[model samples]
Structure formats: C-alpha cells, structure tokens
Target: MGDDTLIDQVRRRYLEVNGDHPMSEADDVYVREHFVEATPEAMALMLEGRLPLPSYLLSDGTPMVPAEHGRLAEIAGGVDRLHDWFVAFWPDDPATAEEEWGHYLSGQYVCLTEVSPVRIRMKTRRVAEASVAVEILRRDPHDPIGRGMLGQAVDGVLAVPGLESFLLPMTAYDRLRFGGPTVRETWVEAPRREFLTPVAPVWPLRTERLLLRPFRPGDEPALTEAWADEDYTSLLLSGTMNPAEVAEMVRRRSEPGDGTFIGLVAEHDGEVVGDSVLILQGTGLSEGEIGWTVMPRHAGRGYATEAARAVLRLAFEHYGLRRVVANLDARNDRSAALCERLGMRREVHRRGDFWSKGTWTDSYEYALLREEWLAQQP
Candidate 1:
C-alpha cells in the first residue's frame, strides 16, 4: 500500500477509539499524541518496513537521521522529547534511560537509533546477514573532530546484523544493556584526524590579483627560492627551510591531513609568489587559524596582505567558521601590520612565552569574529 493510504488507515484506526462523532483538526493532534507519540513500541511495529531509512550519511558512513520529523529543531525542542525518543527504542531498562538521554542531549554520546524496521535499500545494499563494521573512538570530551565523529570514550565496531546498524555509544548504559564483552570494554584511543573535505570557493580560488591553488609539483623550486632567504624567513619559527625540506612541506600540505590544514599556493602572474592556509581548530570546525607566506621578491607589493584576506574570506564566509585567528611572532612587524590591515583585533601578547630557533620569542595573537569580518565586507 502507498504511504498515504497506510497513514490514513492508521489514523482511522487510532481515531476509532474516540468514536466517530465528527473529525476535526483536534483529532489529528489527538491521534499523533496517543498513537504515534504515546506508545513508541506500537508505532515502531506499525511503521515497520514503511518509513524510509535516511539515505544521507555522515562523513563516517553512518546514516544521518536527525531526531523528530527529521528536523534539528526537534532535537532542540526539549529534554522531555529526547527522553521519550530514547525510551522508545531502548525500553528494556528504564533505570538508566534518563542518564543515557542526557548524554545524547549534551553530545557527550551520539546515539544512532533504528527508528523503524530499517532496510538497507541504498546504492550499495547490504546482504540480509551482513553486519556493518563500526569504529568507536574515545577522545577528550572537549576535543570534537567535527560531525560524523563520536566524542565518546570508546572506539571500535559493534557487529550489528545487516549493513545498517545503530552506533550505540559504549557507555555504562550500553554495557549494562547490551551485556557484551565488547560493549563493556573501553579503550583510550588517539584522536582520529581525517583530511577536511573542502567546500565552497572551489580550489583555484582567484582574487583580482592572485590565484590561490593547491600545491603541485614544479612549484617547489619557486617556494624553496623564496623560503631559503634568511631575510624572508626571519621572525619565522622554521627559519630557512632547505630545498628538500621545502619540497617535503609542499608535498605534505598538498595532500589532505587531519582535517586541520587547508593549504593553498598563491599564484601572481603565473608565478608562485606565496602560500595561504586556513587551519581548522576546535570542536565542530567552528574556528580557524589563517596565515600566509610571501616570497622576499614578492614582499612590499601587498601580496601577503591580499592572500591573507582571501584566506580570511575562505575561513569566515566559505567555511562558516565562528572566528579566525592569526598567531605570529611578536617581532614580525610586517605580519602584525597585515593582521591590522585585515581588521583583526589584537587579543593576546605573551612575552618570552614561545621558544623558537634556540631563543625565547614573544608571540602575538590576533582574532576576527565572524560578525566583525562580515562588518568589514562590502
């Protein structure tokens, strides 16, 4: 039967309890409250094989099923609704449901629930007996690696039947409920850093005077020539990186790493004059660090300032970061001036706090909030 027909049948079946006097808008709300919301078990059974499984998958390959009517607003609706959703699927133990709900609410643990009879009917359909390989990772509660990664304290896979399996955070609740050696076991795992998936301003981003592109072979000679100069590298932590070292840096930055670095070389009139980067930091990738390096020959031409502005634009506008910061050696007057030109606020200065090049150097931290950056834009 069609979904509409089934919904109508279920509605009628539910409304029958009220005895047909007359149907009104109130009756629809009544059916939802009593039939759909009240008894989750019956709803689960009734909706079995009917509700479509979410085809959208998180970066980690788990299906992206937002709570309550597929809206994030519902998750923020209230704690009561979150609790109801939890008990609906995990009704066996009412004792710890409250705590489990709290964890899910706070994002301490992310619970992927199999709301209805889920069927793997996607591009790569799973066999009837097949099970998905889950990797549960544990990290500090404060450090989140963005969406699709669970922030909980255990990282491994639970072999739930079929390719579609809910990732139950292996907390005390799951250990008590699932009662498996794997569920009870916990591992202090290192942070899983995947290269960030780039979005917006697609690569080869161009401004009026500069073309920002990813590092490619043959660009290293220009980079080495620029970086090898002590005058250019002065006030820099790495000092003068050798030719081979510069090439290695180019290669590493060219490829994706740890979702932290977005490296791009700035091309001016077909010459690689500098490099620009947007470094994502903090949980949810909500903040970023922006930096640029220009060749000595390219200095005093506003290339660094132009490239830094582009990087800031990418951070605030394209990536949707909450804030962007630039940390530079205190003695780097030119860079500090560039930060001011970009409208970044000087937030911190720590004297002799940073040790670099066999000497203690002061550091400066400049920051630009999203609101501030937006205000500066035309």
Candidate 2:
C-alpha cells in the first residue's frame, strides 16, 4: 500500500550497495513507475478484491472446467506438478509455486471446482488464478460478444453476495471494453537505428556439469543411443530412426566442409549425455538455428540446458550472431522448457506443420536476439 514502486526499491537498493553513488536518470521517476507495476491492470482489481471476483477461473481462462485437472495432479503429485507448471512459463526466476503463493493470493479468490487450486488444497491455486487472469486479458478487446459473455460472468458472481459497490467496477470495465469514450490512437516517436548483423559461431563452451565441444567420430555410438530411443524419436521432426541411421547422421555431420551444421556433444564426467547442434541458416551468417537430443537415461538432469546455453553463448557472444533460434516439436515439453530456460521466447506455435510418427506434428519456434542474450549474461 506504499507509493514505492519496484524501480524505486531497485534504485534504493542500488544506491545502498554503491555507497551513495550518483546515477543519471533515464526519465522522471513518475514516468518510470509504470514500468514496475504489475501487468494487465484490470485483472489486478478482481485479483486483489478491489473488484468482484468470479469463482470459475479456468487455467487457460476458457471459462469452463477441465475434467482431468485433479486427475493429472493426482498422477503427477500436486506440489511437483504445480512447480513444473510455474517453471515452464517463467524460466528466468527459479521460484516454485509454494514460494509465489503470497504474491498472487487474495481473499476474494473463489473456488468452483475441486480439481482447481481454487479449492485451496495446494500451493498451486494462486498461480492458476494468475494464469487465468492473463488468459482472460488476451481476449479481443472490442468483441461485442465479449460484453454479453462478461455480463453473464458478472451475474454468475452474484452468488458471492457482496455489497453493491463492486458492481461499478464491472460496469466500468464493460465500457472500457465496448469502446471507452476517451479511447483514441496516439502517435509516438523513437530514435532510429541502423540494422545490425551478428558474427560467426565460436568454439568449445563450458557449463557447470557439461563440457560442450565439437562432435567426434567416436561420438556416433553415444549419439546414436540418445537419438535412437523410441521415446526420444517419437517427438522429433523425423521420428523413430534406428541406431544405424543416427550413426550415419553423425558421420555426415562429422565430415569436413559440412560447415552448414555444427554438432556439439554434451559431455559430463567423460560420458556423453546429450548432443546440441548449431545450424547456420540462410546465406547470411546473421541467423542461426539450434537443436538438441538428450539421452533417456539422463533426462531431467539439466544436461540439455547446459548444452543449449553454452552453444547460445557461442552464437551470440563469440559468433556475434544477431539471432539464435530453436524449432521444437510441440509435444516435447522438456525441449520447450529447455528453450525457455535458455532465455528464448516462444515466437511461434505453428499448428500441424508436418506429419510425423503416424500423426500430424505441430512445432514451437523460440528465439533470442543478440541484445537479449547479452542482457542475460553477467
């Protein structure tokens, strides 16, 4: 309830650590305050109980209940599943569901389904609610039907039986959505800059538990083992290849003048645990693509993360590449999570982009710019 924004706190902390050091202000403190505020401002009203809250909060804000929600939690353990859910969406911060509960929880949050965290059975509720808030905000801002649906939603909350004061916020939001009277487009200007191109891919990268270096002919066996498993191949663009085929691939990539693709094998304790690739894209060396395959036996050990991150460092810091990207099979949650962990943002999710393994396959495209990559580094 204080006026101190997150930037103010950060600035104060910086000053404390720097012994009263002076730093030039980018803009007025008032102008910068908005940047530190919690996003989707409208949702914060209901979430914090300033406005009426609805009970039926879907995970994706679909406005319906999912039958298997509780069942999936039962299968995966409530705490662990919730933690994974949070980490998958927000990879930069290492905090889990339990740690973020106080930040998202408000007394007005209501429960409609037993499977949902709204039932107050676990630490996952606040995260689920926050996710719902975000999803709801993504709906079309000017859809006429939205007014009808949201009106129905408002009536559905009548069961909560509160004072009439909260009704005004709902009506106000409806006006904002249906076309606020003051709504109009405004033009703003920004400094123009020249287009920048990044450099070439660099070499042997190191991580905490993994040493990522160029693939050797001797790596065919380990690489084949990792790529041949059914569980692994079933999620790849080319599904279910045999060990022999994977070995041939290793040989092809191992050959000289195969500068198009560079294979980096992930070595941990002298054992091959995974393989990551950096593929130069287009005639221009400014863009690069990445791919990874980790051994089934080594799953969940963070080997994929270490390998991907090291290669990313090479692509950005050493190679001066402007952009690095990964294309992942949509069903491969682990790979998608690894991309997120590498600070890559999901830019595309193409539906059924290809047919593979006896079914249509979708793909997720994640990317990071050189500037973004640099910001992540120490």
- Highest lDDT against the true fold, candidate: 1
Query: What is the model-wide C-alpha lDDT for candidate 2?
Result: 0.51
Backbone clash count, each prediction separately: 4, 3
lDDT of 1: 0.56
The models' CA-based lDDT, in order, is: 0.56, 0.51
For residues 54-138, write the lDDT of model 2, one tens digit per residue: 2222222211112332243354465345435533444554564444433222212222222233333221322233234323424
Overlapping backbone residue pairs in candidate 1 total 4
Residues 42-114 of candidate 1 have per-residue lDDT tens digits of 2232344222222222222222222442233244364335446544544675755555443333222223333
Worst 10 residues of 2 by lDDT: 184-193
RMSD after CA superposition, every candidate:
17.7, 23.3
Query: Worst ten-residue run, lDDT, model 1?
Result: 128-137
**Candidate 2 wrong stretches, greater than 4 Å:** 1-203
